[model samples]
Target chain A: MIQRSQLDLRKFVAPEFICGHGALQLAGRYARNFGMRHVLLVTDPGVRAAGWTDAVGESLTEAGISFTIFDAISVNPRSRQVMSGTEVYRAEECNGIVAVGGGSPMDCAKGIGIASSNMRDILAFEGVDRVPVPAPPLICIPTTAGSSADVSQFAIITDDVRKRKIAIISKTLVPDISLLDPEPLTTMSPELTVDTGMDALSHAIEAYVSNASSPMTDVHALEAIRLISSALPAAVREPHNLDLRFSTLLGSLHAGLAFSNASLGAVHAMAHSLGAACDLAHGRCNAMLLEHVIAANYEAAPDRYDQVGAILGAAEGGRGTPAENVAAFRRSLGVTETLAAVGVREDAIRTLARQAYADPCMVTNPRRLTCEDLERIYAYAL
Target chain B: MHMHSDPPDDRDALREKIIGLGETSLHKSYYPELQSRLAELERFRALLDQTHDAIFLIRADTGRLADVNASAVTYLGLSKEELLAMPFASLIAPHQKAAFLETVRKSNEVPSGSRRTCTAYLVSREGREIPMEITVRSVIFGDEQYIVAIARDITDRILTEEELKIKESALESSTNGILIADLTGAIMYANPGFASIFGYEQDGVFMGKNLEAFFATPSVGEEITGHLLDNHTIVKETIGLRSDGSSFHIQVSGSVVQNDAGEPLCIMLIVMDITERILTDQMKRKTYEQLGKNIEQFAIIGDHIRNPLQVIVGYVEMIDDPLAEKILEQSCRINEFVTQLDRGWVESANVRQFLRKHGDGGEPPLQTFIHIGATKEEDP
Candidate 1:
């Protein structure tokens, strides 16, 4: 109880509309609610394979909401793709965008909105709260159970020119509605399920302990952690399990809300670097790097780690210190020893570490790590 | 005659003195019993004044402190005079002052023996604070309804209590899913994180929605839960399902939460969602399998090319290293066989792009998701 009386400000901003389980069935109605005469459906091929594209198209057609499909987006959305999407938006005279996939298509849609309404280059809005105008009323229907991009105000686009991933975090980028239909998520391949599920876990953990965390964020973050931790593995092993898939979807949504406000830490920082340099799966890279970053963060606040350990039920009163807790945590996650096993080479460690240090996510890390320390972490990871 | 007159007067005076002496003797006989009774009263008074705990004598007229013992001054940090002048309500913490005053008002109706006590913080002379356990009673002292309060310092004890509370809160708000359950999988305690994981409110008042609700595959859950029960410890990466029908894959490490009796009151489960690592592991396994199949297919292709090439090499070796003059005479035929075989092998083997890509400077094209039939058909 300090006399200074630090007032804690709390905020919760979710998508205005959340139709969780069978939400996609009402896609047209929701799209119409946005008052768009013509809707542009932006998605990737994998989503098309899952047959969600046709369902969305049919729903819109049945409801008499006019729509055009743009399915050129890939796993990592590119500036060229956004430009092309913008062209499609203009040619079709599509008044709104319904991004119906994981993060990439939605991110591209946001980029398209930026390019169409305001700017020539997508990279110009490549940081926090940079985009000035609200994106064209976008409704996000996530076909995957990961990447809370639908509700998040952030968009990540790849810059082929620089061979780097650019993040556009603008409050105006938030979607008008997020429809998480478990039907589409059940089609996720086991690998996709695992990768995306890990991404959600990373989001939850990072937000739960972020420097900018508030009690409100902490509540959501902790809930996300609990639900994701309990449900992700099951979802991965049995994608068709409606119960598990639904829980994960809800959990991921909460996690997205949390991290959007609280932000993330070094795991994301390092993962972004890996995504840029190696083009590895973001979730896989995060999982690979999570423990090492946890170990590094251990020294910053051992007491917090102990509390976290106790909360995880990994530590008892008579148990060992924070080091033991961290080790136990990694072991529990079933994470392996090094980045070497993940095809990352020793020679690339220095470059990756330097890039990781430059990542925006590193700003809120509890520990102020030096370039040398990050390099050592990369070496240890290897 | 004169001796008789003096003796009579002396006799009369001696009788009056003797009567007074008898009266004094009777008073002296009862003195020891009175002395013993006075000694007992003084001893009781000393015991009350010298006690370690605070003793308060309250006035019925004003409900204020009439007198406080030496210990009261030390415990409450108030001088005897100040304590005697101040109302009991003044000693209470600001937040609790009204509550204490209300309780005192209610105690007025209650009988003296039925007077109650509670834990409270008392203010001191130096403005320092100390928590105390105080007992008050209604007593008749000199025809007034006076209250006696006995209080003791509990500062250290209160600090310990505060520490425990902080620890409990920390555990409750932890980010990790923590569950302390019995061997029967009946949950004894769950942190807010744990409750949220299974899609239950941290303070949800619902029963029958325990650890069983989280297991996506009930059979696996039962197996692991049973294992933890029997073994007192189990740690594994497994899957859980939430109430909303979504699943989570987690790594669970559990240990026995035991009671003082040494019997397991509960098992604490520390669950981590390793869905990311598991997915990567699955990917690695799939890739390894794919790599194996590719390698084996390449081996068959290798043998087909190597067999004829090896025969041609055998023939060439005979021409290059002939054993004798007779063997050397066969060199021309060997030369013809080698040249024909080399030409046939080279001509028949097509330059497969898969092999060429690996052998040439170009790297293998990375696997990416591409939509089939997505490209528009261009007219010639």
Candidate 2:
């Protein structure tokens, strides 16, 4: 018998918005406002092949902004690749940037933007808000439906020296504009669709249970959970389902807005280090590690997990024992299987446990865990 | 009357006894007073002679034959006999004699606590002029007004002041932009070079502008302000915006200026314009980029031309007898042209030597400096 009360929610809106279906169409307009004449368009080979690069280039050309295309960005962008991108940005006299594609391209773009303006080595800027300069006017056009890097104020660049992922999170690095177009995402394979959709779900669910979770973030997180759970399977089954594609795209957007403000939990912290060290997909790592991390967080804030479980159709009438709620949520997300199915090794548990404890995101974990507790969690998941 | 007269004689006797006692007291005080006074005058003379300050005594009636202490001889570079024999006015340098006489006369007229001082030239034994501070104090001695003159030489202090002025002037005219401001960032002084670096007039004074006025970007202002408040000095490179909105780069060294008591008084800004260096750097970067493009284009051309040249060489090697001679000659010309182009673009000292001394190595090396021509000396 939960009574519904009028709760005051605080919302943080962008001072200005550069949004819409083909919002990338305004790249040149925004660039001009920043007094930029030359621009850099950073994207990956896949996005270039899919014609998103041409679309963005056409927009810039229309705005009378001359630009050079850097299609050398790789997935899970390496330090060398970002350095090369920075060189390209400098060589081209680019004063503005347009990042087109998934999290990989946008992340690489953020790295190039920081390194080019600040003149800092890529390896030196990892794990926090180390970048001090405002990046050039950047427009992010996310072509993938899953990675919400378009609207999120976060970027992950690989640190080649340490062989780890360096997460650069700063309001300075946030793109001045995010151009979301569901049309490009229609061409993704079912596997990519499933993986990205699951990533969005992970974002929403993690935000819901985060220690810094607020009513404002909770609304978006719950909406994101509902949209992803309903439309992800449909998107995976039918890549061109426009309705389902819109839902997944919007879901990713909501999750981005939610998690960006509220921050994430231990899942992202551990997933990032593992993905960087092991060269695994970001979404795949999150998917494989999701259940164990949720179970661990449930002990810290059962009510919070219960709210998440209820949002995902796991909690019965939105009320249940903590274990039952989490178990039901695990079953609903189809992540109940052993971590072994996802190619994670039991032998690597100790190393992964230590890394998870050292992660930056662990600072915000509701219940702090010892190294031994981390080991037990990994073993259980394995 | 006779009886009253006898009574009056008793009164006269009492009066005589009183007079006798009074005389005895006066007699006893006189010797001690006179002896102490003589000792006091002797001690005063000895103290005046030992002191470093020159002391002079001027007679009001003649203004000549004045007495001076022993320090006056060394101070005025004069002999004791000459100082005693010379009128005080004669000892004063001709340029200062009139002013000295007027002051001495004024002090005499107002003998009670009259005092005056002036920097004047005093003549020495060899007629050399020594600058000295002459102070006159009027005093009444033996019912006559006498002037006491104390003289001090300040040549060393004056010379040090002149040196400081020269150094300060040199610093003001320096090419390095230097600025000093109060603790509140109010500009106290700006060197000519500092104003000119920002394209301002040498006399274009800035009194109250904050340090933030120099930077175009807010972040730089914030960073510099924080560093200045914390460390008292900061050396950084940033873009400086001119009043005209055009920006230039500078290397600024800022430090806290302190007062005599070591309290912070102001900030000092030393600016070095690095705009030219940044421009040169940008030009060098552009040159490198152009070079890279040119290299890529040249490589493409090399590949295109070398492929056909290889075919020609292959066909020529396949030829035999009479046609072989024509084909071989043409092949050699083509090979020579290719080598010429290679040498133009590439220079490998070791590879060229190896190629000249020995035939091509069997294995292709990982790194190749592909020369397109023969050596410069070998070329026609």
Question: Which stretch of 10 consecutive residues in model 2 chain B shows the poorest summed lDDT?
Answer: B21-30
lDDT tens digits, residues B5-123, model 2?
34554676667445532112121122235435756997998899988778888776777656888898887787888788877888789987888888777776764786888878878
Candidate lDDT scores, in order, read 0.72, 0.73
**DockQ scores for all predicted structures:** 0.00, 0.00
Tens-digit lDDT track of model 1 for A1-382: 0111126665656665454566787677766655567888998888888789889988888778899889898777888899999999989987778888887888898899878777467888888877776666787898776688988877878788887777777788877777787778898887777678778867877776677677777787777766766777677678789999888888788888888887888888888877777787777777777767777887775554555555444322335554454344444445544578777898998888887788778876767878887888778777
Error of 1 at B198 (Å): 99
**Residue runs of model 1 more than 4 Å from their true location after superposition:** A1-6, A307-337, B1-380
**lDDT, model 2:** 0.73
lDDT of 2 at B261: 91
Per-model TM-score, in order, reads 0.47, 0.47
Residue B83, model 1, lDDT: 82
Chain B TM, per prediction: 0.56, 0.66
Off by over 4 Å in 2: A1-19, A314-338, B1-380
